[model samples]
Target chain A: MANITNDAAKPERLQLLRVLGPAHVWALGVGIVLVGEYMGWNFAVGKGGMIAGLVACWVAGLLYTCVAMIDSEVTSTVAAAGGQYAQAKHIVGPLMAFNVGLFLVMAYTMLEAANAITVGFLLDTVAGMTGHSGLHQQPFIVLAIMFLAWLNYRGVLATLTFNLVIVAVAFTAICVLFFAIQFGASNVPLDFSAVTEEPLPYGWLGIVASLHFGLWYYLGIEGTCQAAEEVRSPARSLPYGTMAGIMTLLIAATLTWYMCSGLIPWEYLGQAGTPLFDAARVTGNVWLMVLLFIGTIFATLASANGCINDASRAWFSMGRDRYLPSWFGAVHPVYRTPYRSIVFLVPIALIFALGAPLDQVVTFSILSGLLGYTFMTFNMVMFRRKWPLDTIKRGYVHPFHPLPTIILLILCSSAFFAVFLGYGTQLIAMMCFYIIASLWFHFRRYQYVRRGDQFTMPWPRPQGY
Target chain B: MAYEPKKQGLAAQIFDVVTLLVLTVGALYVPLYMGLAGAAKTPNPIENPTWEALGQNAAEQRQWEALGITDPASVNDMITARFDYSFSWAALIIMIVSVVGYFVLVVRLSDREYREVLDERFGSKRKGG
Candidate 1:
């Protein structure tokens, strides 16, 4: 092979600043997902009752554990803004990379829209309780999206620093609620029998279906890799931060399941708009209620904030590679942020938040996420096949490689089945949507993409080609 | 210098705009047309509303008795589990084909494009190229 050199002078390219550490990475990942503990996970209980909900939680946890381990190993080496999209580009090729990039952007953007709508509904709920029932939610939703967009537009450091504080506070509130209900000054009573009162109400199939809501428990934890380019040291920070984020989510998911299941009947708990808030309301302690309410709002805001960060990065990366319009590729010279992409996504998120039904919005987000995880399964297999061990220097190597890959594939298939149960038509429709998108990319978008220049990593040729 | 992408032709831009409009509408309407719209919850009120009475109420107790859901083992009869899981072989086959076919196309296209990149960056005489 011919030797390559950088002796020729190169033009200066504005880039995202690398100023983050493991803590910021943790905050980015956990911030995007902590909202799950406050509201969504209880849907599993409605699907299969407490025991099945617990099973689904552990199963989804195992799925995400594989995601984190595999993502960490690959991300430590790829180290780019696009996360899995970057991995797909280097390990697979343009078509898969384009789809993965679209998946990341769609998933995070839809989640951001959902978070904004949730924030609006939350404020309206607080208003209804205070006797001001006719509050307009649109302004609140618009404000939430615009403010977070502004934060992201400022810089990554400020955005993630704010995320760290709120995420820490939100996580701490969950711990406080757990400890208070378990052994606090509150005189609130608990019904420990309520947990096991109705076990596996839907049987085995219910456990399978519950895997859908179980996803809400740790949905966006893989977002940590979106920060790879911005991290001070991708090799050290990506693995450490992502693993720590998943571990924290596991504990948080369990605590949330336990506390809510103990306090409320599975039937009512499953249908609650905000189970943690309802768990606090059952206590009749005004202070605890206020804390949990704040926790819910902060968690939603944190999620929207992180979604903006990740979605914008993915869009910006794809833009940089000309997979999309080149207009979105610009990084802010002064702020060192993906300003164009951030600004461009605000209106898309706003329309979804204000126009679409909340459930559908969330369903779209979840399915998009599932597609990304499914992509990771193949991405990991290809990464191993193309660049085997010791072929290139790796920052971190996850043990039992094929094991994690197999587990991820199984869990992903199960989740697909779960989505199919309730959303069969929607599942098929989303597949068609992506197929159309892939066709568009293949015929229309491929020419704009710099084919030879798309490979950004410094690695040797694949073993087989 | 970083690799910046070339500009698109007008036809591509028009295709982009038209496809985006179609997809956005499809994303919004397909679910609704498919009956995936969110269902409004029916208010289930109980007498003497209290935290203790939230789940264990006369109405739910009646529901439990009527459905014979007194024990955890038979609780499978509860309402949420009523989703019809009747397997449709045709639908499953269509889904399998759609997904698998997409992957097949991706892999085949990727092989061709990836080799072209290798040949451009390193001469075709190179072993992998």
Candidate 2:
């Protein structure tokens, strides 16, 4: 644990270790990465989707992990709470940092909005059973946001511990459902024929298609590092939690999903509106369906709760840095929660829920986050080569420094390529947004700067040898 | 066009609901309108040529001649004879291009923000200022 009073030892902000631990943080990672999207990836993409997604994930994963790893060295690294904002200050200076910080606030807030909508989606399912009308009414949003806000106002450690309990119960229910699906297999034909006879529906294009769904598994990864100060042994835990959640779910979830697809028959799997839920219903055991409902609801709940908590932190950090209003920086004096920041995201979340369709929100959030992952990969490479290091030198070294780093760079680049190849103009439009913002900030940050003088791009991050 | 998340306030919500309704309608209605209906129970591919011949080949012949096209209405009887087998394929293509296209767009925009975050997260540590 860090000594809070020893300001002279390392003064600017509070250290991260006081708040989180390896196990708890890993759960946070798991909470975000494990979701319906993983199931979609498995069923839709099939075997080939797994190969391509995993390969891309491996590449991008290293880059993301490297970002967290290099971060271990900073006493109070950039600015307290303003993650990328602080990192930007190091590499590009205040203007770029200011722009990036604003971008992050938008990104995380949108994510919060999307997750709140997800809460409505899950609850809407509950509403279906009771014949309730318009559960998505404004009152529900008020209730959900306020509840989440209250949960957060309780403080970081408490919020995490509460989430952990919720997540644990969720996982236990998930285990029961998994077993039911596996056991209900009356026709457990161990034949590997499905891969050959029909072969995954989309063929080559399927792999690229799968990335859309598959990438969702990696969405919550960045959140884990947001509380670097709260974590127990961040040097070790951050890396472990971030990557483990990804790799484990990749392997475990993939196998389980494959089992479902292979065993369930393509027609049934494809047709079921709620495939997992439908699968449970077919088991001839009402008990199993009940269990699956529990699993799915909890999955959505954990996602919503965990996302709101992290979203507030991102806001608080940004606010504390004076990038946004200083009001965003407020922490509950008693609970040490980001009260103002968390409260602020509420209506934005409601509007998001009320406005956008569900699938778009999910896909949009994942896409935006993966873009972040690509940059992280490049950062890892640059950090290894260009970033300066002192107190924290070697955290988690990429197995092959330059090569893996290079591969990660390519992989991250591919995320851009994948999105564009898969999306085309929409991708272009999205980039134009940031480009417009980036340019606005650039011109505003540096008045009357010529294109020739714009040769230099941002500043430094660390690497391990 | 430069894409912003919401064009205006209430308009955004209206657009969202409208877009979703259209997409869902398309997803559902397209298949019904075009998807192969009443696929004459395709028997498992078997070694028996007579059974196979009795199925598609014989059925295809009926499709052309049954319309009394002995003189063949200008176009090749074979062309019309060819069963309209591509409706389902076309429908599948549209559905896929749509769902995947929708998300890919979302992911790309998300990536832009994500990348900047990564740069700053790391950039902060490098300078140590």
Candidate 3:
């Protein structure tokens, strides 16, 4: 065990392969998020009607645009596996870093669990439809989690390449659905009347409430930064991949909203389980339905697979920094994956998938993501304050400095209010949970953490000496 | 071990472990015990309900009912339920102040410590004479 620990501490062993390019990073980010365009985002419509939903989508897009710009800037320079966690460590302090790491782990794990559960249920539904009943969801859930984990543990290139293909297929399905409906291929004509009639059924306050659900449109896009260490050229690839991912999501989101709202009534669209699939079904075309069904499944699987890659990386980074046990930091000798961290998270995710209520699981994941975004606002501010522009060679410098930071803060605070308006208790509970975890880390974990080793980037001293 | 971890007394380690366990449970369980977790209790079905099953067709609704969703309309209502819209100003203000205040404090403290590092590494900056 001691020799293994010594071996794990070697710099060569600790390093992740720099095989990933911009496309892999794009696949990682978009693979995790494209699931949103297929479902979940419509919940905003349920909260605030059609107009509020559209407004929320655009507003949320603005919030994430700020996030992507800030993330691109810091991630290009930091170029680490922990993403925002690494940014917080270098820019803020240990406590904030620990919290950010926890946020990433919890956010991605819960999301992975949610995706696995969805996959299990999807397969079970298929079974029931085909005259088979009592196909228990647990084995399928376990299988999905295990399959994805095994894929991740094998290698990064294969995993992300697979993600790229399925994500492309799912994204193409959305585009096809949009164009087919646009060309009047659907027997039913698209209806724009719903937009004008009862635009804001519940008033502007509903917009505030809807903002919480709006996040589903682009929740995990910031996850692109987790691939910083793996990218061939962190400065160039991280920014390019992240920006491209966000643009793709933006177009897909707009197309999804347009197609679903035009095809289905607002009342039903607001509460749809699978809005895109339903839209295809409404088109009265068998092939469209089949294609959309495949799209939904692929999106779910891709999300789970991406979540595994990200959560393990964040956990592995934390372990490497001594924020968690060093046992989890070990990279596989051959596969070059954070094999232990990948395996450790499997049971945690499986437990949540099997036992917890789905809505509660989703709420936990969303709140954790919200906390990460809030941290990015301060992280960007401090990063610029410490490093300045000319002090370091930034791979990509965000155009506006404090403007994006300020906008992100306001939007983040508004999202906090939106969560408060709806899920007041879970919001507070999540805060309390993080607070307790923070206390644990500050009091215990910080001592074991080495300050010198934490700042591993090849950058000069921060300014203002 | 080439890298030695910081040594702590057994009592302190145990205390930290116990505190983490108890507080973590309290943080997660109290709200759940208070019935505070049920913001949206919709069935997260993998497939979308058909139009006929959404009470658009009487026979299909019956079939759905037999399949276990006794009342599709209630489920619809639950899924489409909007927030009350009115939030307590006190809660919102407190939340904003707490978050922004925390960020401000972290930034200020981190700034001081960071400068201390810069001073150690680059030598203390001499003021212009």
Q: DockQ of all candidates, in order?
A: 0.27, 0.04, 0.23
State every prediction's TM-score relative to the real structure: 0.89, 0.65, 0.87
Which consecutive 10 residues in model 3 chain A have the weakest lDDT in total? Answer: A1-10
Name model 1 segments beyond 4 Å from true: A1-12, A184-188, A192-195, B1-6, B9-18, B33-87, B125-129
lDDT of 2 by residue, A42-119 (tens): 323331333444443444345445544444332123323444544444433444444445445444545555555555
Model 1 C-alpha lDDT per residue in residues A1-465, reported as the tens digit of each score: 011122211211577899999999999999999998887788878766788788989999999999999999999999999899888888888888888887888888888988888888878877887899989999999999999999999999999999999999999999999888778634445555644555665678889988988998998999999998899899999999999999999999999988777666677677667888877876667888899889999999999999999999988888777777666677787998989889988998997899887767777888889988988888888888889888989999999879998999989888878777666777777788888888888877777766567776788877677
Q: Each candidate: what lDDT?
A: 0.80, 0.47, 0.77
Docking class of 1: acceptable
For each model in turn, which proportion of the native inter-chain contacts is also found? 0.34, 0.01, 0.26
In candidate 1 chain A, what residue range of length 10 has the lowest lDDT sum? Answer: A1-10
Which candidate wins on DockQ?
Answer: 1
Candidate 3 on A190-304: residue-level lDDT in tens?
A: 7656467567867887787788878888989999999887888999999999999999999999998888877766666776667787778677777898898899889989999
| TM-scores of chain A, one for each prediction | 0.96, 0.77, 0.95
Clashing pairs in 1: none
